[model samples]
Target: MAVSVYRGFHLQSAPNSTEVWQVKIKNHVLTGNLAAIKKSIDWWCETASLIDPREFESLNAKREESTGALHEDFNGYTLKNDTGAPNAWYCFFNGRLIKGSKLAIQKHIEAYLVAKQRAEAKQAQQKK
Candidate 1:
């Protein structure tokens, strides 16, 4: 059983005898198996109006995330794409975990680096 949240949606997967998956977006609640939930989440991520499916594709054409054939690196951290849908990613930073899109993890790493730099500068000033 695993519980994960994405874009304000809570997705809980319980691999029991029934293999049920429940999703909650705000007050809206949906219950179904893994396939059903994946479809629903994919729909929610894309626009309501019909458009080219290619438009939703990521800029990184060199690698397809859904295949899990490859992984990317960000700030020296390995970004394992858990699911192409909802753009879920698992970025490992010394066991620190972040689950989100590439941009989300980038922002997180940027913030961490900025804080680290500030702390180092403060320590240097104190020693002077």
Candidate 2:
């Protein structure tokens, strides 16, 4: 279907496939992502129709997966109540300032947190 009615995700036909009756998971177009599948499982964990990937060998996620985590959490970063700039968001990370719109501040915080986590993980691996 060429419609956005499917919640989470669904199968859709490829454009200019050069073949008849071919379909692929709609979100796979983005990669081997699993946000949609995880959402489906969240909604219908028991009664609907979802099998746990960890339990079932056939339902394996051999590639990438999305945890569906919210990116807007403060996560140790503090927000400043608009200091003269209209419609702007000021974010402070341990005293360092980052000023922008709300979305920009959130993006910055998410990127910082991800980088920090990666760095710590790498450091631990070096220790090992």
Candidate 3:
């Protein structure tokens, strides 16, 4: 994935609050870390759409072994709009609007998993 396909929060009312700056790129408008995204337009672009992580787990019957909450909503910090809406952002590639925080978290999770895999592989090789 290109850098321009990722978006996330820029400014929040609180440390964990979801209210953020809104931005417009081309024909699509997105709300998040407006200044940061504008600085790195390509990387900040919305690339993929994501469903809520918890709902997905439940629908797939892939419950976790240990649990407090059944599902984890990565966008908890994202504030609902005036219409009580969880606003979304647009992808630079297709100009498709998507959930900003969820997509950003998804991208981070992907990067973390890949890094972990690589580290495990390296450690295994070093042991051999």
- Candidate 1 clashes: the total is 0
Candidate 3 has an lDDT of 0.41
lDDT of 3 by residue, 2-118 (tens): 123334423222245444443445544444443333443444344543223234335334323322222243322222222222323222222333345435645755676678899
Candidate 2 lDDT by residue in tens digits, 25-81:
322232112434344444454456443323332333322132222223376766654
Give the Å shift of residue 88 in candidate 2: 1.6
Clashing pairs in 2: none
Worst 10 residues of 2 by lDDT: 18-27
Off by over 4 Å in 1: 1-68
**lDDT of residue 20 for candidate 3:** 41
**Model 1 residue 17 lDDT?**
35
lDDT, candidate 1, equals 0.66
TM-score for each of the candidates: 0.45, 0.37, 0.26
Error of 3 at 39 (Å): 39
lDDT of 2 at 48: 60
Candidate 2 ranges beyond 4 A from true positions: 1-73, 83-86
Task: Give the top-scoring candidate (TM-score).
Answer: 1
